[model samples]
Target chain A: MNEKTVAVLKQAFKEFYFKNAEKIITPIRMKEREFGYMSFDKVMVRHLSFQTEGDLRAFLIKEMPHSVYYSCAYYYEPTFAMDEKGWKGADLIFDIDADDIPTRCKEEHDHWICKDCNFMDKGKRPDKCPKCEGMRIDEKNWVCPLCLKATKDEAIKLMDFLLKDFGITKENIEVYFSGGRGYHVTVERSALEELDQLARSEISDYVSGIGLNLESLGISKRASYEKMQRMLPLANDSGWRGRIAKFFSEMEFECYNSNDVKDKMIYIYRKMKHKNFENFVGEVIGKLSTKIDAMVTTDIHRIFRLPNTLHGSTGMLKRRCDDLLSFDPFIDAVALGEEPMQIFVDHSPKFTLMGKIFGPYKSERVKLPLMAAVYLIGKGLAEVD
Target chain B: MGIEFGLEDLAKYPFMKEAGDYVKKLSLRVEDLGQEDYRPAVERAKQRVMEAIQKNYISIEISEPIVELLSFPLALMLVKAMNVEYIIHRYSLAEAIRAESLLKEEKKSIISYIFKSTFNLEPISVKHELFDLKIKLIEYLKRATHFHEPEWKLINRVVDNGFVYLKTHELVRLIREEIRRTIYDRMKGVSLPSMPKNLKEAVHEISRVLPPRSDKFQRVTPDKFPPCIIYTLDLIKKGQNLSHYGRFLLTTYLLSIGKSVDDIIDIYPRSPDFNERMTRYQVEHIAGMRGGRRRYKVPSCRTLATHGLCFKDKILCAKIRSPFQFGKKPLFKKKSTGQIRE
Candidate 1:
């Protein structure tokens, strides 16, 4: 960014923090927390402390940081050795990233660049840059409707699993749009407050469906030569068993045939028991299991972006999700501001925000709402006109 | 026919030799577990432990796990007698921590016993670090009843963080290992139940009847009933004969939920083995109309499972202690409005 644009952004940040300083609140056991922020040159200002929320708010307004974060961990003293830092406990958290969701949008716009050779190509990222065959490559990912929607579905699925399988009550859980490209689910039950990293990891594994014992799950092979016909039991069952049964019985793989699919699968399963039973069942589990960022859940020492705070990357609020089904990130997560500003647009896909269409423009100077302008500027795709 | 065995008799099983010898040497009363009135036996165990404590001579030869096993009934009895928040003992810090770890791993059993026995004892004196570890472990065990696959790395984190107190935690592991080996050795020559060919059906039966204990639950809702009550209601609908304990569980559970004695007795008539005079008398006895004014709390979920009666299907089965928790509060009243999560 030019010095003039950087000055404008800093001024905007200062004004916003000054007006909204009252909204920020520190987490529990505040005395043992380490605060951090991003500076203009991407320098991380860490190991910072504040006496009160008021002090923290004043610092943010004065510094006009690009973003802010507080440690998820609580300690006896903020700056102490890892072992000496009395580990109190951490809230159980799960992250679902849109970039991780497998979808067709990747082929359309996702690209990779050879960091060594500067060779760029659009489409699915290759392990090594094709032109330079360089090992050091950087993946450039962008969020689209398909990928974001898929991630939302994954998040909802994970939420259901947490409630039903992990036995977490719905009331103890809070879901938030990550303000960039996904959602974060935090569990705040007092009972779970002191769960060590290990206990939380088991929860993460269950949510991600990792290291599942197939034989114990009743996916073992049986010798059967007879013409076996069965409707996989779906009714009066619960958990994974019921889910698997319903998925197969519903014939979702065969264009929703729903007619005799269970019988056909049963026949095929019995016939192919000696050869493909394990693979088939494994495939089903992979399809059904929730894909979550395991590190987020297990890292008791992690620092999560504070909820309700603005995310510098997308210029969106890390908004709480009230209803999973109706959460539209583009509209619901947009930071509330109505003032319009003119900006030089670079490249952007056709995107919808606040029930209005914007972009599909390439390098055009255009006037847009403050939120849109901030979003474009924040993404580094546009500059102040 | 009920099987009969004394504490000494357990020595013949090989695994119980050390445990049996200690009990015999201590002159602990080895009551006939087969008997219906085992209350006096447990009371005697409590008395013996108290006597030993008074004498200042608890046998150190007995392993920590064995000591715990012997002390369980005693601790339980004492907790009820004292009605304390927890049962604490003045013992070696190492021993206490070791005992706690083994007890901690058995989450469901420990939690149910702790609640039923009302034990809330802590160690008399210890280093602050080890004390904190024990207290944290105890608190963790009390709260954790859910069955989750153990991750050793996480267990190591506790060990690493509590490095100064690692010796105590290691002793806990040693006790666990020894107990496990004893069980393995005892079962070596014993004929095990035949493995089910239809493993899926078998697993389904086990999970349905006894879902792994978890603390998670929606607040008790109007439509959601405890599994024991649901199972008993199902049995009554099918006109099946109920066991003595089952009958007691049902009567106490129903009465506690405000069901009238007449209403409870009416449901029993549908049972194939129902005797109007006998059923009414037993129901009245449990309702505290005949049996001394003392009313009984419903048996713990583990006790229900041992009798082959627990029918856990709903997630609520994981957390609740008694059917009474489902009194009037609708489970997740806030969830109905869709504002709680946000």
Candidate 2:
């Protein structure tokens, strides 16, 4: 980590424990932190012993890397007077406090990351590097974005990587941004209670078993789903108003069924103050295809009503079939790419809106044709035959 | 949406079909009135027409054929009401008779001289063109009639059809015109001027046949009568409103605003109200007068004039002319050197 990053971590821990640990001590012999040994190549650790926490802290700074460390919570147990084993099962527990060790252990060698796909290399963000002529370095996951070459996917997994892999229990899994370029998944302080003490090592092992690769997180499912959008048809006898009410509540309106739809629509349109209704409401409804899986009523009137058309006012009741294509809902999913998207479900119009002007039998009363045109236009769907 | 609902609802009304059938029958009768018959017709023709109009809009109106047959009577009434024979003769001759002596006037703008020269000799009742206009007006009125009786029934049937219906204004016009013609003829043969001074005296002998109301108006002033109603009637002939009610309203308004009743009676003027109903209508609307004037309900005279008049219908009210457009004309002045100036 850079100096500022180190300062942040130092301040976070020191602010809480600074007053309590004035004369903290460690065992005179180099105390064993953990007995398990790694049989793999390239494993080394620096060790030192101290009488005071200050001395140990100095030693940690002098030896450890600036970033990248893991903590294992384990301690020796004590027993109460057994016959032969004495204090084995019956021994008082003794724990070595890890407060003195820095979070990172610095490596002696320099690190490099790929310029394109994050293939990391050691010995400086290299010039004309072997894997990639595009110069860059990585101390973590190494995939070269500039060159086709890639390192083993298991280059280096941060605590965040582990969290993502195991999908932290809902309580601990708050998503946030890392300082730059990627997201940080913080297993919250509350997670301390949720982690199973007996299977602490198993939890870490389970995270590794997820088979996450650094190079080719091949074809993210989110990306491909955008390519398959469709128009959501109007559903009959559906309780969609409740859903719309919830959205209004989210927007902080506390709207009710009695509230005038036209008034609300007029308010929204005025707030947007955009010359083009298409661009304005498109923003709010566009994100909603996935989350709510339906468009809001506020979207329809403020935009697609198109009152100033050449003919005259057109009204819609239960969605009109002819209106489908004009409102081309099946555009790119969330507009991230060229993948189409549609409302997973359709919504209907309120009946009170259309008037009861009597006309020539069914010809006048049942103006379904107008309704179809209205729906298609409102949704921005491509007109269909 | 336009007429479908209206048509259906009308069709279902109990008497509508009967009314429609009767209207059609009455229309046939009116057409037959003129052809192959002179005087004899189904008895109570006017009553039949009224009932037919009550049932349906088309049958009540005088058919075109009926108007042709009845033209002489209609035309006679119109000429008498207008007093056009004397007026036209004087007006036409006054311009071209520059010689001051009748025989010495030279023929200038020959048609004008012919009119000026022949005007006195031409029988007031027999001018073919004027008679033709009268006949045309009668035909127009006939077109407005219903196939059945009563004006309303006629309106119900032929509202948007291509028939040329008369407005209240036009009805008012026809009334005045008919009165003018009738008065003109009544004066003929019954009385003669024998060199009466002031055209009014010459016309007076003829105007005696006028309706009592018209006569009362003519007596309002020595030389002036209420020309307002008469003038309004003249206006509606060429420029008319859509309904007869509108015509009545406008003419009454003109009478209220224009000449005195004595002035109108001094001319050929009459109405049933004229002989016995000449009561004064007084109003006080000044603020703080008569016990603090709390009676805000009392409308202005102009507004009061609107009440009980034929044009009470809002749609008909559209024809009511602004008071400003109905005021008197400026009298022509004679310039020096014996020349008439406008």
Candidate 3:
């Protein structure tokens, strides 16, 4: 009823509850890395359709072959509604064979990926049921660069940075397991109306922008068809999130960025402090949405010059924003490479006038939601603790 | 006056931003664009003179200084053939530049009409040929630019008319020769010395090697939604990378040829190995190459497997391949650069 955005989460969920009150809606958290392979050693393919029944069936058959479960995919807004084009989502990924996709992978395999020296081959895989000659083999387990356990610590630290930076508090933040392999940290839409699209994206960019020697966060420009398959929703990942945690645990949080947070925030003792982002974020609250394009541009005019933003159109081509339609944030997740890939959507997840979290895309075409980003940061934080 | 647009204005275009710091890019293509900046000024001058109904601006007439002056025919030609927005692309400009170069360098008249015409800019023989081409080009632009969002289909009309204009004089022969040379020069830069002796032979070689021209490519054009494979094919032969450029080229090419990767792989058995290896490079280098060339610089085992060059440092190479992870590779202490090209 008002001009400002109000997350009728209570209302929306209540309505969802009324429609499917007999059903369940679990907040799923996930943090995955693109393994870069499809079912049976081929590229993965995810089907996208304008028809609800057809696409849902296809996705169920392919991605959830062992299980018949589906997450809330990008069904609303710009991505799903655009020109109705179908794509074979594949991302050529190099899987980190570090810890069998998990830190707690007790069944036995390798674990650990190094973020500092770009060291992927870490930990020991026992041969013949014991530690194999792994201590010497330094760089082999690289299947899941994005969610490898070691880097999650760095990933989560950035989230903490954003929380304090954006003036977001725990009461305002909600975390969930992505039902598969990641964490989803959600800040109520009502709480975040203060941040503009660019500000929100900068937060995304910073978490992802943090570079680890082994592999950087987000999608690669040269992602291949086969690579897209691993990220495709059609090819399911059963244990990817665990692999991400293992990687995070292995890497001791090393402060590489001059402004990056180096430790965890403990809410129990009120010993919560994110070293880097508090200042800038505190200054930006309340004045965000009202800032206007001119003001935002003036504030972060340097954004137009960042290497990624500069040649953006040619790198990641998407529809020109000419309407109010939003790209269901889930669409980007569905299009991901089984990891936290940054994405951008011109409008909000619901095609709301206020554009929200749309980033960490697996490819230039994919646009992940803030929900996935939240999980990634949450998992990243949990790893630190 | 300074060109109204700054060099940075190139950034606003889709491809230029990736082209990177405009002043430093080393390509004839960039130079050609620079020359194009002269067009708007030239257009304003022409329009002002037309409105004045005046004989000259400073010392030059609205349409004179060429050996022969046929204002009516020239204006009519412009209205007929070209689209102002699409313009005579660089290839055509190259044609125009080359032609002008010939007249001055050869010490001979380009066409007989220029010597006997009403006024003079240069003592060239082929003033009529230049005038006719310019007129036709401008007229074509008038129609093309008039419709802000004209269908790409109109390109066919322009090309059809353009072809007709090309046939009017000896210009056709010169263009063919220039096109042949341009094609040859590009290939010569890449194709091994053993490949071809001259331009004609080179064209024949590439035409023969690639899949045959189907009706789709022969007739398909920009007007069509899915453009012909020829445009992309042209980009590759012009020197885009085999991974980035090659993928886009192969996708459209296979689509046009109606062939699948499987079909091509069958023909080239080593394709899978090559694809994985090459794609690894594409992904690894993607970070360095995001801007364009930077996206293609990723080091790979492909350098050793396909080429004799061994990429030093196994850890570094693995890190590079991190962007292209697809399961895990068996770790062997990465060996030194080995000559593995088969």
What TM-score does the predicted chain A of each candidate obtain versus native chain A?
Answer: 0.85, 0.20, 0.25
lDDT of 1 by residue, A1-385 (tens): 6676677677777777788888775666667776678876688866666778788888888887777876767777666656667788777788899877788887876776788999978877788877878899877676777888988888889876766544567888888888888998887744666776545665565556555543333333562322233214342234454566666675444333446644555555666663576677668777888888988887888777777677877778787899978999988888647687888987666777788888887889988887887777887778886
Error of 3 at A94 (Å): 20
Q: Report, to 2 decimal places, the DockQ of model 3.
A: 0.02
What does DockQ give for each predicted structure? 0.02, 0.00, 0.02
lDDT of 2 by residue, B233-311 (tens): 5444444332334333433442443444323222222222222111111111112112244422322325435643222
Tens-place lDDT per residue, model 2, A206-316, is 222211111111112232222211111111101121222233334533343434433343344345443443353344332221111011111111111101011111111
- Candidate that would win on TM-score: 1
The candidate, 2 or 3, that scores higher on lDDT is 3
lDDT of 1 by residue, B252-287 (tens): 877776666665776686788776556765777687
Of candidate 3 chain A, the 10-residue stretch with the lowest lDDT total is A305-314
Model 1, residue A353: distance off in Å is 2.3
- Model 3, position B150, has a per-residue lDDT of 17
Instruction: Give the alpha carbon lDDT tens digit for every residue of B1-342 in model 3.
Output: 122333322211101222233323433231232244433433432242232222111112222321112221122122122222111122223333433333233223322222112112122222331123322222233222222121211221212211212212433233333332332233223222221123223233323433232344344333332222333344444554344444533343343334433233322223423442234333323433211334232223353335322323444344434212212344555777878868
Candidate order by decreasing lDDT: 1, 3, 2
- In TM-score terms, candidate 3 sits at 0.24
**What would you estimate as the lDDT of candidate 3?**
0.27
